[model samples]
Target: MEINEVQKWIKSYYGQRGWTDYGPFIRVGFLMEETGEVARAVRSYEIGRDRPDESTPPPEQLKNDLIEEIGDVLGNIALLADLYGITLEEAFTAHKEKLVKRFNS
Candidate 1:
């Protein structure tokens, strides 16, 4: 799925649920919360937690959790981008192109 397609899907999905009514501040707050969840999932998946029960999730389960959390983060990011009137594809490519030039130099 392309970023533009994903962004449109996100917009439509959120547009139906009253999420589009929230201000940028609320959207950003949700984005930050989702980011934190992604970070926590990554840490738990990479390092065995102190709890014995969490030593290691089955590979399938670990992958599922990571995917779900990352999806959440991406959704929130799309919403934030929508709120700011930013096209994720353009923004991502432009920013990445700058890095590409910097590295190639």
Candidate 2:
């Protein structure tokens, strides 16, 4: 699905979960937490080792962990844009133009 569709899906899913009351700060917090989880998953993937005590998730779990964390990050980011009254399409367009000027020069 496109980014716009993804944003709508996140809103619908969370709204159903009684998460409609959370503010931008709450979404930012979730974004940060999910990012950290993605980092940990990457670390485990990079280290290629597992702990006997299960301090880290096994290698097989790394892929799914990253997927889940990344999805959460995207969902929260969409919520952030929505909270600020910005459409995801407009944000994407502005961001792409910014990148092109910064990198295509």
Candidate lDDT scores, in order, read 0.85, 0.82
Whose lDDT is greatest here? Answer: 1
Those runs of model 1 whose alpha carbons end farther than 4 Å from true positions after fitting are 52-56
Give residue 105's lDDT in candidate 1 (0 to 100). Answer: 89
- As for model 2, its CA RMSD to the true structure in angstroms is 2.1
lDDT of 1 by residue, 34-91 (tens): 8888887787778745686545777677778989999988888888888778989878
lDDT of 2 at 33: 91
Q: Per-residue lDDT for 1-105 in model 2, tens only?
A: 887888899888988997756888888888899889888777778884467866766667788877888887788888888888887899989999999999999
The model with the greatest TM-score is 1
For model 1 the local lDDT of residue 4 reads 87
Clashing pairs for predicted structure model 1, backbone only:
none
